[model samples]
Target chain A: MSTKRDKVIVCRCEDVTLHQVDEAIARGHRDLESLKRYTGFGTGFCQGKQCVALCARLLVERGGDPPTKPITPRPPIRPIALADLARLVDDGDGP
Target chain B: MTEELTQPFDAIPDACDVLVVGAGIMGLATAYNLARMGAGRIVIVDRSYLCSGASGRNGGGVRAQFSSETNIELMKRSLELCDDFATEMGINVWLRRDGYLFLARNAKRRAELEASVALQRSHGLPTRMIGPSEILSIVPEIDVSGIEAGSYNPDDAVVFPWPFVWGYARACQRLGVTVHPFVDAELEATGGAMSGALLRSQRVESLGQEKHIRAPLVILATGAWSPEVAAPLGLELPNHPHRHEICSTEPLKPFLGPLVADLESGLYFSQSMRGEIVGGVSNARVPPGVDQRSSLRFLGLYAKALTRTMPILGSVRVLRQWAGCYDLTPDGSPIIGRVDSLEGLILLCGFMGHGFMIAPIIGLLTARYLLKNEERELFHRWSLGRFERGELLPESMILG
Candidate 1:
């Protein structure tokens, strides 16, 4: 059985293990961003919406530096259906 | 975050002067520009919410040092817009023009950099080919042991991707452009010419049933997923979605000043204004598909590359890691223009990996083409039909 820390899944969709992240970190990747590239921790269908903040906090706990600013936000917080996105103007919801 | 039911309706219940498909950066930016132009009623639709595709997932590297003259010009114009984006759109976007530094290791790569420098210089871009000694002068922290030559363009930059999209969406809303989220748009045609679109899967309780949107001009700005949306319409686009991964480091004492791209390892790094070192490398070995699921293999590859490129980052902690998709075309150039044979149907797709950097200018140019049929010479050469006609724009600076 994997250890408690090892059992945690960094990438939920891909089922990447935390041990894998630790191993990569041991190989000179100590932070979240680089750890992400080395471990594929947050790249998923949710596009890191679910894990980016969590990862950020984890990195801080792991002795990572706190960012002077917040993480960069991309668009489409939710994956709205293509059909639903087309009715914005005519939906009778605007002021 | 406004509720849906309260929007305006009943005025024919459907139809408009223009209907833009795919609510990515291109579609949203184009819609906002059209409305700003005082064009007749415009409705922008999407297969998913804004940034569902490449727009939301890209690394947000806004650089004007493109190998292609056309792309360089387009990005130069777009960078100008991004410089004043927050004030212009009334939104705060972290637009940072920190500059891009492409590091060359081997003699062959150095020669290529020299050639690219000549092209960029000819186009009036502030780019120069420097040697290892000169590179150390710019980024003193970077370990240039194996590196020989480099290209530095201070004008190239980066920006936060989300606020840019929101800025455009808000601007479009203020200009009276209809913005719809979660509306799946289907191409509804008539005769040989494109007519209107049918928005499916609408979840409004007040409409009594699903809603429909019929517009005169239909624009497809769906980045990576564009081919699927255009397939049924018989419009063959060469855009395919490729997964590109990026990650961030725990904030640190700002060290890296410019975006560094190591041509040897395909690794690039930049320090965010927030002091977090953020960047990614080219994975030529990544499987070519739309699958966004992260993998352990990529992590291993990235670690090796970063360690080899700049050993100074060995002690830095990683804050987060994520993957994004790129709408890749045959020649690394975007196909922007009116579709063949389909009147009133325009395509602003196939930006490959450079769409986010040029969204602002592309929006204006595409709107100009659709509104006045005035095709700018810049984007005219990047038409969708160029592939079949054997005209391919090769951009060597493309990262993985």
Candidate 2:
């Protein structure tokens, strides 16, 4: 069921469909980063929290070797509130 | 023959006339321009895929409302290029020229905006200072209670970021410029001159395999990673990386038009063509480095700032949040032009966070300088030696 194209949303945040992932792979983007760039999968709001593993599996299934190196995840792993960021300034820890 | 062509490492040439490092927008644009000008044997190498750097990660805000003369001039040219990019490059970048609305909450900030608007008007940019009511007319959803004044430029635009990179890459490919992804390049310099680069394939698990690409001219467009790439060759660059985080809310019915930015809080956001509210706020606490980690603190701050400026955004669900590094210099302007200390090595990094907006003009200018020895006054103003000479051209209107 998970392998079904329309049923699976690889990146829920971006609403990237499984068919889109397959198409990206078919176009020679067999790696996580290239797939993310081409299909807008892992770069959404969650920043790959729900999609990286699914993308890796698709890459392997499409005759590509498993990614030996992990795709480097960009920061703010979890969503935080705006008030919390302003408090950093009050605490004198602002960037 | 087809198998050899498909092989990753085999596609990389042993030597080229010009070797460009970094496959981001800057590198690709420069390569594309060089190829168009009949520059021979150009090769572009990236440690990661194209647009993986700040090019792919920015909020895609392009504006001519700058505080400095040089930036305003450069961005004017860049805006024209972006306007014609779709027709010229055969790619629809989705250039939406709804305008940019910059808000000021206090007297001092309002004064700065007024001065900037005046300068912009003098330079023929259709930028003007507007009142609180005018701001509301532009963005009816904005809560302008604390806003003292504002500036608006209807010519400023928001573009789809990924296709801009892809369009340049495609054009480069058409011009016979070879681009190698997942290849790490180490500068091979001798006596303050670059001779070649030692390339390592990052795709396979080859323990000791390395390829050397000998070239006389090398352009460093590595963005945030510029310092680390230069350090191996004993070159010290003053540029540092500052992480800026952005979040996108779920798509909604389009209510906002202009990309609204609060001058005091460093919060800026715009709705994409597909309707996602994409924007971020700057934090003063993010330490300088290549750390692209997003913080819950940023999310919280962005939420508060967004709600404070535009209360309508409070109900939108933030679908995702991410971060990218801004190649920051002490003066806030970029480091461009040839490095006097390093012969055959050109520098094109340190754009703060506005590299994407200015890259089109820089690419053309850098290519012209390289191919025909055409030097512009802007290049001289942004040279690397300006730091040591203490002749800083600080830009006042920098936002995330």
Candidate 3:
């Protein structure tokens, strides 16, 4: 919990830093969902794969959670083109 | 962080003055206001965590631009309350009053908008009808090629929806009201009145064991899940939970002036505080449920509609897409106040897609009604009994 590690980037997809995550936690966003939202961590290009665990661990470090529960995972876990996804559904193919 | 916020939740009480079901914005707002007015021993229980329902899953658009007088007046007050929310609740909701620009793609829709704008203007709302050329100046980000006319209101705004739930719940908790999350409630009616509910924990330690709690008054803020609570009681509250979906693109330069909506397709988009172009389109083709999953159908519809309206956003990559339920009553308006025969059970639901927008004023008014028995005409007009009497003032300005 040193200030030296404060600026370390946790969510590369959104460029959310560890300091930002800790700050959100300190401001009463104890749950992973609110933390994910307030810090914009797990909602970036990686869709939480890169930063969810880090943020969850940080929540535990701040004495919060059943840390296993992360934010809700949505479709197309990897980034996909909007045109391509539209085409995929139009062609009768979907997840 | 304060000591009270991170502190562990207190145990559920066996009895309370008011039992509020669903800890979403409506319930929390109502509960917080009631507790503030010295309504004793308020307890709120939800099946999921905060922001887990329609309250959290909305576009957070608060506007007074509506065709009806009641809708316009309620939203006008809701906007002011939102302006003072941060100071009063001690949480920054990140409210941005960039305004809402509604576009009409054809002559028919343009005429409809013109009439609505006139109605809005008569109520002292600053809504103005504009041409496509003026629409370009409002939001150059949108391509106004097919747009015939537009409705521009500078007061309509957007906010980060999560903080409203958290702020209200925290305020309630600080006022000695226990706002329990991850807990389920089964409505219990005895003799005639509601006798509170049977609570069961949904967490790992204590799960599915019901505990009886007694209270004379119970409020159902259950939103789309009200049918389940109503069915066993033999009360016919007809509605369906339409799953509405939304998506956000990667952050870009913040250029969009207002939340833009296509009056024809019900397609709407706005730039978030973080600069992501977040948007959604109207879709009711799917089945109704609280746990409706996201579908490729939503992405397809939204992408086509959004791209067709704003060609510049065709290549913008979608970072996330999710779905939530819109609690649609038989009539478009919300069903508030009391239900007949169900003496102690009150209904504060069916606000449709604009519940989050109007919840603040409704919550304040609902709390006043409970405290002093003050009768709001909206409570009577928006009651479930109207459906039986054929007195439906169905609202027309609903969006996804």
Candidate 4:
């Protein structure tokens, strides 16, 4: 059997451990965004792609209400290169 | 004891001496400066939580190696402020000054690096041009075959971004500045002069109760949302949001010492304090907007680019991928100063991607400019009217 210190990472993007999520909840981070900000859970490169659902489940399992709403997702749902966007620059001469 | 000032709209005063529009680093730092300067009745409102914008999502690289005299000078002061930001803000920001190494793949880019190093050295920055062998010596893991030349500055650094934002928020609250998160504020213009903003709760229950807050001075520090915020007031800022994505790999024993950048591919990465390799590469086809979604294309591109530069990272597992908006400007320079079109409105947006690094100094300079009427050279060079005057100052050292 795995010991309690054996870290089970819930958010792979941020390397957030399940223990850390419990600690965040203990510290009163009830909502998804609050938990995210407190524990650096869903703010990684994947931007919570795999961790949001896991966090929601953890919240429910811990007797907390499911997050009132999923954390607000921002743009480019996937990582895009800056050079790719720079190539779309019109340089002001488009008719 | 610092009172909890992050209250809802109903608990806030209807008017203040200054109303800061965004809660990102720029807005928060500027409000902290204003409060420290004893500006009375200051209130800062954000549509999202603290550090939810570009300020929170950046790669946390701070460098003074720039191709322009203006940028180098500004970054020099900014670097000094960042060097002591932890002590100043009363928080450990995990600042690491290992250095930043920028590589060039072609002769044209090498020449650009050389010129930029010269300009940077002229401004007292210790940046210098180096060959591939020197680059290899600094970061032995990188593939030096294709690298023609490089520029490196030992003074450049990186910091954990979340603590920086939290530090500023805490300092602002301690200084008696009110910060309201989840509050939607819109600029209100009356008779071509500046007025106040209409505030409403972003929460579902109090959605309809709009509160009007009056202030003589309104500063727009909304990074990607700057244009949207100014559009209703008839101000057309040329700044647009370009999405940039970054990824982090699983922690490994630290080998990389400095943030490395490919000048051509716009790929930059640095090892974090916790041994995670964090960085991003620029894509050529992303559309302009605030879309911050991560993509598989970025992963493939980053994997290829990173391994090509440093082949050993190919086996590293990428743990997370995320995206943020860069408030791109037409001239590739930031717009900072009072707007001539709006009477009491000051413009402080269009930082491209380096807003986090420059926020500390900008906050100080902007406070001086607004409170003491200090005319700074940065304000003149990066004025909003420069774009209209056909005078553009484009910096060549921008990397993602």
Q: Using DockQ, give the best candidate's number.
A: 3
A17: Cα error in model 2, Å: 5.1
Ranking by DockQ: 3, 2, 4, 1
Name the lDDT value of residue B205 in candidate 3.
41
lDDT of 3 by residue, B1-400 (tens): 3434322234787899999998888998898889989999988888876788888888888888887788998899999999999999889898999888988888888888899999998888889999978988877766778788899999899999988987887788789888777678888887777888877887544556668889888989988888776777778787767888888888888888799887566788898888888888877577746655787788887887777677787778888888788888887888999888888898988888889999899899999988888866768888888988899876777776
Worst 10 residues of 1 chain B by lDDT: B3-12
Stronger candidate by lDDT (1 vs 4): 4
User: Best to worst by TM-score, what's the order?
Assistant: 3, 2, 4, 1
TM-score of 3: 0.93
Candidate 1 off by > 4 Å: A1-95, B1-13, B202-209
Q: How far is candidate 3 from the true structure (C-alpha RMSD, Å)?
A: 2.7
Query: Compared to the true structure, candidate 1 yields what TM-score?
Result: 0.77
lDDT for each candidate structure = 0.70, 0.84, 0.81, 0.82
* Residue B68 CA displacement from its true place in model 3, Å: 1.5
**What's the distance in Å from true for residue B43, model 2?**
1.0
Every model's TM-score: 0.77, 0.91, 0.93, 0.87
Q: Of the pair 1 and 3, which is ahead by DockQ?
A: 3
- Candidates 2 and 3, the one with greater TM-score: 3
For model 2 chain B, give the 10-residue run with minimal summed lDDT.
B1-10
Indicate whether candidate 2 or candidate 4 has the larger TM-score.
2
DockQ by candidate, in order:
0.02, 0.30, 0.42, 0.12
